[model samples]
Target: MTIETETGSPEAPPKTRLHVDEPLAAGATVGLDHERAHYLRHVLRLDRGDRVALFNGRDGEWSARIDGFGKGWCSLAVDRQRRPQAPEPDLWLLFAPIKRTRIDFVAEKAAELGASVVWPVLTRHTDVARVNVDRLRANAIEAAEQCERLTVPDLREPAKLDQVTRDWSSDRTILLCAEAGPVKPIAAAVAGLKPGPVAILTGPEGGFAKDELDGLLKLPFVVPVGLGPRILRADTAALAALACWQALAGDWATGGADARPPFRSQEPG
Candidate 1:
């Protein structure tokens, strides 16, 4: 088996990128599971010798060629590294779980928007009793694949808001999206935040209870921030806060290491 060299070319990258748990290195053989194998063979109709991209959280993205395929299984030969592993924003998103579809949307968008962690928080006003962490992880994985993210957001088990707050680390600031009470506008608040580990917390559709809000405000790490005068849905608030943070203080801002043009402009010639 021959190992290819990295070219750092301006051409477009492979469209099919998959996240796997195995290590990625030159000449390494990666085997796809049944679901992914089915996706490539039946759904994508890709054949042997075709190319795809693979990445694990530890290794950077790599180009790989289909070496062989069969029923419910496929193997790829790692060709070369494309992009080096780069630093990403250490931002977490904690929110009160909502309905199924909307929560799925939150998981997907959070991964795309550079959230390092996605945790479901149970609040007094939260209506949803159960959270499907596996489903959230799947959505995060799919979103990371589509957005060219090197790693998917870590999906945490559902925990009560009070318990999470009690055990929270003081070094990481929490920007709580408050619907009422004295709060600084999101834009203004994020602008003053120092670069470090941070998290965005959003309430459920019904909003946080008065006692819950009061409890959070008392915490030294919590900073209440308002979206606007108008009320936003649970999912909307979470994504909005995430986007604002990324734009203002996260990796989306100017002078970041991973700054680049949109994916379409880099298409292969």
Candidate 2:
């Protein structure tokens, strides 16, 4: 039986991509742990000499051949580089924690949308008390692997809204998705600003308390933008704001079909 990805398409056998911490260079050997070893050996049923892609965030991406495998581990020899490391848009997503499933969806989609950082901000209306940073990181890693991103978004621990805003960098602008306020249309707001370091902040499902919204407004870097007449859920608002930013002022404006070269498969020698 052939395994299919979420898209319902047959997964490419040789194009299995793994994010690893070890440096990838020609002739360098990398080892996988038991979990990954079991995945490749039993789940994928891959054998020796099968080629796989590896990325270490800093090393771009490399093709490697399975050199050895056992019950608990697998080793691969690095081949040549497939794609060089390239810069991504310095966009951040800051949101209040929501329910478990939605928060997970947010992390996954944020990675696919090219958020440079993912941060949880505790607001007065935020119902969720704790955030599993490990789980968020795992979701991000998996998303990066599936989406072919060179790097995973930097995940930050949960912080209070006041603390986050107080320590926020003046250089980076925050596009606050405000449900009620004096706001500019998202597209218009994005069009007015130059493409630079930016973050999108979405409130909780219950919305930010009045005082919280007021505090954010006083910040010079915070620019509240309106999505439209209709109110959106916390997750919807975050993603919609991000999509607008990317389409107007982020990498999406400049990236297209020819943005990068096609992936070329390498054969083991």
Candidate 3:
């Protein structure tokens, strides 16, 4: 079918979500590029007139319909807004890139945990010299879609750890996951920190070099913290620190400490 009318006059809107960079409003039209068009037409097998939700991270969520479509091209007619736009936490995950899959996991988890930015850092012990920022951004977008996040986290290009530290915003606190020196519990380290403009630094699997560690410790804005008595993998440390910050000082704590379960506990199928 080229176009589909709402079934029974009350068909449920499509659940597909796409992050666009344009302002969204009723009656506005949006064009899908070839890749996105392929996903809509061939991958999802959607016909003209099918509905799709759109979010630009600024104008909130909107319900849009496939008004026109063909091979590698599609246009959507914005219909109505659904959810209102909300501010994302200003937390940033600045970590040394690990293996390809593990670094990807860090990006996805960071997005899901509401990190406003994901930065790739190169440390003395970093094994990987470069990272695919596109892949990281795609992972962040997919995570945002799955988790009902209105916006995707900003992914940064790879840069040397030393330079990143030198240019970091001094007004923001940088929590460094260190195994040595005066270390506080991750929770205690983040205590009393507000939701805006904070970043966490996790090192590579081999840990930071002595010089690098000293450099970070000497940064006036850096706070060295430890996950626990036990050491965690780089990816694990990033996710754990994010969750700790959220539960301790981030938005997740707003549920009043006695909120419902973290997530549904149903057994896997």
List per-candidate RMSD values in Å: 3.4, 5.8, 5.0
Residue-level error in angstroms, candidate 1, position 258: 7.8
How does candidate 2 score on lDDT?
0.88
Model 2 is weakest, by summed lDDT over 10 consecutive residues, at: 260-269
* Stretches of model 1 off by over 4 angstroms after superposition: 1-5, 8-13, 255-269
Candidate 2 off by > 4 Å: 1-13, 260-269
- Kindly indicate the candidate among 1 and 2 with the higher TM-score: 1
TM-scores of all candidate predictions against the true structure: 0.92, 0.91, 0.88
Candidate 2 lDDT by residue in tens digits, 154-239: 99999998998888889999999999989999999998886579999999999989989998999999999999999999999999
Rank candidates by TM-score, best first: 1, 2, 3
Q: In candidate 1, what are the lDDT values of residues 133-196, reduced to their tens digit? A: 9999999999998888888899999999999999999999999999998899999998888767
Question: Pick by TM-score: which candidate is best?
Answer: 1
Given candidate 1, what's the lDDT at residue 224? 96
Residue 251 in candidate 1 has what lDDT?
A: 77
Candidate 3 collision pairs: none
Q: Runs in model 3 with CA error above 4 Å?
A: 1-11, 192-196, 256-269
